[model samples]
Target: MTTERAYRYRFYPTPEQATLLARTFGCVRFVWNAVLRYRTDAFYQRQEKIGYHDASAFLTQLKKQSDTAFLTEVSSVPLQQCLRHQQTAFKHFFAKRARYPHFKSKKHRQSATFASSAFSYRNGQITLAKCREPLNIRWSRDLPSAPSTVTVSKDRAGRYFISCLCKVDTEALPITPKMVGIDLGLKDLFVTSEGQRVNNPRHTARYARKLARAQRQLSRKQKGSNNRAKARLKVAKCHAKIADTRRDHLHQLTRQIVNDNQVIAAESLQVKHLVKNRHLSKAISDVGWGELVRQLEYKAAWAGRQFIQIDRWYPSSKRCHGCGFVQEALPLDVRVWDCPSCGTQGIDRDLNAARNILHAGTALLAGAESCSKYRGALGN
Candidate 1:
């Protein structure tokens, strides 16, 4: 089996290289926004009258009208990759995954990138095609053999990264017979059917106060002053550090889960909806529920294990895991209860919920047609 992953590296750019990098990033942004506009026009025009062709042709036309000439200088890989971003947006629209294609704005985030294999990376230095200076490399991982492309760009906080796209041989993991169901909650990050409850790290909230103070300091600084700029960098660095710590914790947790379980079952959490509800918003966001689901998904696939996502509204919390008995109402405050039907004492709410999730997933694995209506109270 073959798999693809970007091995990112940090590059140290000199003043001249930094300027050129900024220019390249700007050019990329311009192309992306232009393609978005073209796609939008094509969409509307097609609705009025069919005047559309393939996306590649539209991208080709944009290249002809390039402003920086830097756009033309970067290998077609970055250009094509840049265009692909817009195309992906268009695809999402067509597939009803998103409402409409949104315009790209340079002011929103990180500036530019050159994503092509044409950039030379040798002895900790990378040479871009149009630029005279070479970037000092901070290689994080091995480069793919015979890569189709590589991208060099800076992120929001002035950190440089390189993304290489290449094919690599990846053997499929052997499918295991074991299966486990996972229930996610604000109280605990994850609870397994086997009575394992992973504590909600709450890493984001732990550092939120400090982050808020940093932001306040940043806001007080004069916008154009060097002190203000340095202050901003300090804030950015702190935020990055927090993010890295959380990611590290998550990686260790997810890997442990994946390594232990075979057939992994989990509730399809309505994270976006849950976040909007003001009462538990902070707690909800703190746990990174959405990110957890994503990690479990890709890792399960990578491990060649059965990863079944039960319905979002599956009544895992309310239902009795022992007898599959449904309950009327189990409020968020209620942590445990005795099942009327089965007379089984529920020790912990999250564990019971996880058990229910596992049971429902098992029913699904057994080819059940219907799924539970809610992961919480059935009626709610």
Candidate 2:
């Protein structure tokens, strides 16, 4: 299948390139905030909905004015792209898929997207609009094809990255009869139906002390001072480290799972609601359940494997995989429980959940009759 894929790499910008990119980022942010404010006021005050074309026209008019002429100095593609992005955000909001769009902040990570016309690519070199020299990109891997679009971004830690979107062909993996079910938890990252347990690294907890010390040093420094800025960068670096490590680990783990199994089943967890518990919220977030599921989904699709998510309301943990007997209550603290009806003792809670999930998912895939029977037996 031909799919659009993005490859991101860290890049070191020249002094002149950095200055131009900084200006471009600021311009994009300013345009987004201004257009968002305009649309918001128009909606509440006059019951008007500002579309992308109208916003684009507004941008053109603003450029003609003396006060905002600097917008024309940088690449115009990214500015227009931001307005389109805002339009998409508003669309998603009205469709109830996302919350209302908000104004961009200068202190946060900044990015600018450039369309094909705004940049030139040749011999593994990329040159943005209005620049004489090509970007000094550290090519980690060769692109399958030239990119159709490019995005440049800078994080709070002052690291620059460029992402190239290119079209590539992906072939499906060979057919496998192996299937597995996974149970996610705080103690172990995941438990498989086959009784394999993957340990949760707890990346955030590993760096908690260093992050707290950096934050403390930042709080002591005067706001707007150079020392404060340095301290803030330190804190950002710690966070970046945690995020990078977690992402890398998830990618590796998901790839292995997808390669090994033809059918993968897991419970559908509402991470937002799950994080409401103050006691377990930090641990839940540290485990990156959402990220794990997301990676599994896309990678499974790319590999042409079946991925199933059991219903959240399904009694996976409480239901006995041996006899289909459903327990009334199974507390989180009780990791080992016996099925009273069947007298099956020492059932590992997570492992039982994984087996039940596998049974439910396979029954679901079999037919509606089987699913109905399974649900009836489980009282779900």
Candidate 3:
């Protein structure tokens, strides 16, 4: 099978290259902010929406201006890519897929994209545009194919990475007969239809005290001082570490689940609405239901496995898998319950939910002619 994947690697830049890259990042940020301001103003004043072409056409004039002449120091490719990104952001906003484009901040993550024309790879080294020396990259793995584009980014922790996007050939996994359903929760990341439970890593909670201490240290330092900067970096590193741990665990879990099951079913959770409960919000976010479902979805597609999401309002937890009897009031505190109709004793709520989900998903798949219809049904 053919696939498009991004390979990311850490790279160390020489002082000169670092300066140039920093300049490029600044220029990209500047262009994005400038165009956003322009677009916002035009939309409000003239009821006109600006687009990529208009932005690109105006870039030359922008660089020629006295105040913004510093933009000339960086390669024009990153500036153009910045405009393209802003344009894409606006498109997503209009489509209601994302929020409106906002001004880029220097304090946060900064990135610049390089198109095929902007970089060249030779003799196991890659040279970026306007740089004399190739970046010293720590290649963790070999690329399947030559990358068409690369994105360079610097995180708040002062770590630099380059992500290369390329098309690659993939060998499809062998089809399996087994199927399973998953119920996500705070206590356990998920409980499978096979009575298997993957405990939630609780990455944020694991390091919460350390993060709190680091944040406290950051707050104690006076703003604009070197100590404050160091403290901020510490906080960033802590956050990065937590995020990395969470992501690594999720990837491993998802990979194993997808590989084992030919058909994977899960609840279509309304996480945004669920997280409104302030008491449970932290725990809910820490579990990352959305991230898990997302991984299962894309990985399932890649593996040619069926991924079904039962409707959120399907009453999976309340319904007894044995007798298909629905309880009128099943409270969250009721972890174990006996089904009145089926006389099923001591059934775990999460396990029952998983089984019910699998039953519903299989039934829907057998009855429905189109998967798109089921997807639309869940969306509603």
Candidate 4:
């Protein structure tokens, strides 16, 4: 049986080590933005001079620009990879899978990494290519396949992370009879088809007062002063804490669901599009739909469960689970409703939706190819 896998672990790095990692990340951003600018300029020139333009010819040459001292700071392989990504993006755009190209910004949280870069972990010492200073690490397990490289990253809040690209052959999860469907909402985190409720915990919003006070202190401090930097760090730490708590809660909940079930069905949410509606956007963001689906994806695969994704337009909410009658209009505010046909009253919206999601999910599981077609229809 085929099984999915990943590389997971934490790292221990000193302050100096972190700075070095940050510099490498900067180098990657510099290369990408530099080429991005070059490509845009070339395309504009071509459009003006001739009738049409091509990105490949210019991007190909851009990759090797560092050869004659044009871009000395860039690693050869990484720069080539960046150009390859541009080419790939264009391919996807032409295929109608993605949007047209856009510019990269320094202000945005970003990083570029080369998969060919050396990363060796022997005992507690981890060595990076061309960098003599080795980082300290305590790996939780003996890796099955050696990691070819590592990606060092820093988020907007200035927290550091390194994703080790090691390989492992996870055993296929044993099968069972249990299957479940879940509905996602803001007021309530999740409601399973079996009546299991996971309450929504708004970690970030819970600390809104503390965050406001920190901003007030930050505003009062003189710009470029040591005190200002310290205050900024405090805010970053607070944001990080909330994110950590939310992740911990998600991990624990998903683990329970995956371990106990052999089949899992969920909605295919268009999270990016859903966030555009400003009226309920904050509530949607607080619900954390994207993160929840992401965790479910890998966890389901790890458990060897049949993971089914029904259509976003599946009308999971407006349809009655007891009968097949569809309610044409169910407002967001009406949390509790009764099925007129079956006389089932006091039906909780989230729970009823979960049942519908499961019904759709179960239909998909019986025919694996149909589920694949369903995902393909969504351009997955």
Best by lDDT: 2
Residue 185, candidate 1: C-alpha displacement in angstroms: 1.5
lDDT of 2: 0.93
Question: Which is superior by TM-score, 3 or 4?
Answer: 3
Could you give candidate 4's per-residue lDDT for residues 1-380 as a string of tens digits?
A: 34324454556667776655666565556656665666566567764221113333454455466763444444455555556677677677768999976766644455545464555567645676545677665567765655665556566666555556655556657888998999988777989999988888888789889988888898999998999988887787787777788888898998888888888889999988999999978778766788888998887876677787888887788777777567889999899998887798988888889998897788776664554454344333
Model 4's alpha-carbon lDDT is 0.71
Q: What lDDT tens digits, residue by residue, belong to model 3 across residues 282-359?
A: 999888899999999999998889999877878889878877777899999999999898699998999999997897
Per-candidate TM vs. native? Answer: 0.85, 0.97, 0.95, 0.82
Give Cα distance to truth, residue 62, candidate 1, Å: 6.7
Q: Candidate 1: global Cα-lDDT?
A: 0.71
Error of 3 at 152 (Å): 0.4
Q: Lowest summed-lDDT stretch of 10 residues in model 1?
A: 371-380
The stretch of ten residues in a row with the least summed lDDT in candidate 2 is: 368-377
lDDT by residue (tens digit), candidate 1, 1-380: 78886667677878887776676677677777766666567557765311234656766766676554556755565566666666666677778998775665653455444444457666545677766777677766666564555666665566877666678776566656666888887767788888777887778777888889889998999989998988887788777777778777888888878877787888887787888989888788777878888888888787777778888776778777666677789888899888888688755778887877777777777777658323222332
**TM-score-sorted candidate list, best first:** 2, 3, 1, 4
**In candidate 1, how many Å is residue 43 off?**
4.3
* lDDT for 224 (candidate 3): 99
- The per-candidate count of clashes, in order, stands at 6, 0, 0, 0
Over 1-380, each residue of candidate 2 has an lDDT whose tens digit, in order, gives: 99999999999999999999999999999999988988999999999999999999989988999999999999999999999899999999999999999888988999999999999999889999988899888999999999999999999989999999999899999999999999999889999999999999999989999999999999999999999999999999999999999999999999999999999999999999989999999999989999999999999998999998988888899988998888899998999999888899999999999999899888887763544577785564
Q: Give all candidates' CA lDDT scores.
A: 0.71, 0.93, 0.89, 0.71
